[model samples]
Target: MILRSLFLSTVAAMAPLMAPVSSFAAEPQLKVELSPSSPKQGESMTVIIDPPGNLPPSDASQLTVSFTKSGAALAENYPAFPLDAEGDRYRAIIPTSPLDSHGRTLLQVSDTIETRNLAVWVQKRNFPTQRITLRGSGSGGATQYELDRVAVFKDLVTPIKYWNGIFRAPNSGRVSTIFGVRRYYNGVFANDYYHRGIDYAAGYGSPVVAPAAGKIALIDYEKNGFRVHGNTVGIDHGQGVVSILMHLNSIPTTLKEGDLVQAGQQVGTVGSTGASTGPHLHWGLYVHSVAIDPVPWRNQSVD
Candidate 1:
C-alpha cells in the first residue's frame, strides 16, 4: 500500500509538465494574404493577416516581416501600424534595390501568432545613355563654364530634409543610369560624377507621381542660366526623405511650395527639358542631402 501511494504522487507531479507541452504543440490557426504579388521596383503592396476568431484583435507591432533578395538591397518600413483607432490593419512600404534584376525574390513574415512566406519576380528594363560633345562658342565662355561647375559642387554638401519614407521611386521606367555611375563630360574626366538620380526612359507627357505625401519645398526654373531642369519641383516628405522631380514639362496647377500631397499623387509630367537630350524623367531621391539610388525600392515587400 505504501509503495502504491508513492507511485501515484510521482505521476501527479509529472502530469502538470506534460500538460503544458501538449498545449503548446497545438498550432494557432491563422491566415495571410498579399495584394499584387508581383510589382515593379518602387511599388507598395498590402498584407493582411486573419487570426482565429477566438483570438482577440491584437496590435500589429508585435508582428515582424522581412525580405531577402539576391544582388539587391531591401528597403522597407517596419512594424508600421496603430496610427488609427480601428485596430487590425498594418501597413509598410518596400523599395527594391538597384542591383536587383529580372529574377525571383522572397518575403518572410512571422510572429508569435503565425508565420507566412511569399516569392515574387521582378521585371527587367534596359536604360541607355550616349555621350555628346559640348563646346563653348564664345572665346570667354570656357572660363565661365569652369566657374559654374565649381559653384554647383560647392553647394552639393548643404544637407536638407526634403522628403520622408525609407525612399521611393519618382516614376516607372527602365532604369537608364544608376546612381554612382562615372561620367566623362567634355573629356575633362568630370569629377567621379555619380548619377544622383535614377533616369526613366518614357514618352513625353508621362505622368510623374510623388513617391510619398509631403509639402513642396522648392520650385525653380533656372539652375545654370540655360533654364536647366526647365521646371522642377522638390517635395519634403518629412524625416529627411526628399523627392526631386526634374525635366518636367509642367507642374500641376494644384501643386505649390508648402502644398500638401499624398503618395502616388500626380505632380508633373515627363519631358526633355533642361539638360536632357530626349524625352524622359530624371527622378532624384535624397536623404538629408545624401543622394541614394531609387531602383531598389521597386517591388519591395512592406513590413
Candidate 2:
C-alpha cells in the first residue's frame, strides 16, 4: 500500500509537467510530414512539422504527437522542438508498437485548434516468444522495475540536448531476440508482455559501445538481487531520447554517471551476469520513456 501510494503521488506531481500547452492562437499554419513513407512494426519513424514563423520568437507552441489506430494510442514520443527561424520544419519520432497493424496507421499531430492526420503504411515484422522462469527474485526485480519505470518516464520526456543524426549499433553482433514479441513467463500469460530491446549474442567480454552522444544517466553494479540488470548503464541523448545497455560482463571502474560519451564509445562488455542464458548485450532505446524499435535508428540517420 505504501509503495502504491508513493507511485500515485509521483504520478500526480508529474501531471502538471505533462499537461499540454493550451495557449496557441486559432488556426496557426502548420504542416506535418511522415518520412520513410513506409515503416514496420517496432520501427522508428519521423514526423516533421513546419511551424509558423510569424509568431514571436518566444511564442513556443506545444506540439503533441500520438500514433493511433481505431482510437487506440499505440505510442507517444517527442520530436525535436522549436521551429527554427525562417520556418524550418521540426522533427519528432513516431515509434511504433510490436503488435501494430501491418498497414493503415493513423498519426495525429496537433497543437490546440489545428489537428492533422497522416496515413502511414507499416510493413510486417515477426517477433518470437519465449517462456522462461525469471532467474531473479520476483520481489526485488519488481521493486527495481517500478523505480526504473518511474525514473525513465520522468527523464526521457525532457530531451534537453540535441545531437544530429541517427544512432549507431552498440555492437555488430547478431540479434538473439527481436523487439516487441510476446513474452510468456512463469505460468503467467499476459498479452502485453514484449521484449523491450535487442539481445546481441557475443562472447564474454565482447565490447559494447554507445550508439549516440549522450550523458550517462545511470550505472548500476550493485550485487543485491534487485540489480537484475547486473552492471547496467543508461545514456540520455537529449530530445527525450535514451538508451540502456544491460547484463554487462564487466563495467569500467572509472566510468561514472553524468559523463558525456560520444557515439561508439565503449561502455561495457557482453556478459551473462544477469538472469541470462548466455553472454549477450541487451540494448534498449526509448523516446519519451516509450520503447521503440532500434533497428531503424541503426540503419539510417533520423533528422
Candidate 3:
C-alpha cells in the first residue's frame, strides 16, 4: 500500500510537467498515454506520442521521445521506432525491467521548440519458469557475431524488470539449455557466445504465450543459412522494448502485423521449424534495440 501511494504521488507530480506546446510558440504539443494504464513491473506498455498540429515536414526529424526510470540510466536504443513508417505520431513499446522496482517512469516528448513529460507508476506481477529446449542453426563463421551480441547485452544493461511480463513454462520438463551458458557446436569453441535466451525443453505442440502486451511487428520464416533465428515472431512493446519468440511450429495465420495483444495471450506453439536441433521456444527481450537478459525479469518482486 505504501509503495502504491508513493507511485501515485510521483505520477501526479509529473503530469503538469507534460504541457502542450503553445501555439504562439513554434513547438509541437506533446501528449502521452499508456495503454492499459496500470501495468505490472515486468509487463510491457505501448507509449503513444501525438503532435499538436500539422507542421512542415522539414522539422519532422527534430521530434524525439524518451523514457526513463528514476535511478537507472536510459538505454541507448530507447524510444525505438516501429518497423513501419516514422512520423509525428511516434510510437514505442516500452518494457519494464525487474530491476525497475517501484518508481515513476518519465516519458519525455519534445520538438525543436518545446518539450513535454508524463509520469507513470508500474505495478508488480508474478512470473514463473518452465523448462524447454531451443534449437537453431548458424553459419560456421558467424560465431563471433552471435557471441558479441550476448556479451554486449549482459555488460551494458542491468536486468531489473521483466519487460515481457511473466513467462509460462512452454513445456512440462527441465531446461535443456540455460541462459548465458557457453556452447560448442560440433568440435569448435563457441567462445564469448553465451546463450542470449532461455531454451525450454518441451515437446512439439506446446503453447507459446505473449510475454506481455504488444503489437506484432515482424514475422519471418525464410531459410537464411547460419542465421538461426528461424520462423520468428517479434512483438514491439511501446517505448523500444521488444520481445522475440523464435522457432515456432507455425505462427497463427490469423495473426498479422499491428495486432494488439495482452499478457498470456497465445501467439504460437513450440516446434522445430527453422535451424533447429529440437523443438522449443527461444525467448528474448530487447530494450529499444539492445538485447538484454530475460531471466531476471521473469520472476521478480516490485517492492
- Per-model TM-score versus the true fold: 0.47, 0.75, 0.47
Query: Evaluated with lDDT, which candidate comes out highest?
Result: 2
Model 1: weakest 10-residue lDDT segment is 153-162
Tens-digit per-residue lDDT, 1-303, candidate 1: 689446544543333233223235564344445554554433333455554442323465566766566455773333433322454444433444333454555565655655555565543433333454667753322234434532342223222223344445667777666654545566665543456677888888888888876777766553444255556777776434566788887778767777787778888888877767787888776543445555444444223
Better of 1 and 2 by lDDT: 2
Looking at model 1, residue 296 earns an lDDT score of 49
Candidate 1 regions off by >4 Å? 1-132, 137-168, 222-226, 299-303
- By lDDT, is 2 or 3 better? 2
What does candidate 2's lDDT look like per residue over 87-169, in tens digits?
A: 36666776666755666566667765566655566666777777867667664343466367437633664535555577887
Candidates in descending TM-score order: 2, 1, 3
Model 3 per-residue lDDT tens digits across residues 184-303: 555454544545566777788788878777777766663442246666777775444567777888788899877887777888888886567898888877765444456555665111
Q: Model 3: runs farther than 4 Å from truth?
A: 1-173, 184-192, 223-227, 301-303
Indicate the residue-level lDDT of 138 in model 1.
30
lDDT score of model 2? 0.70
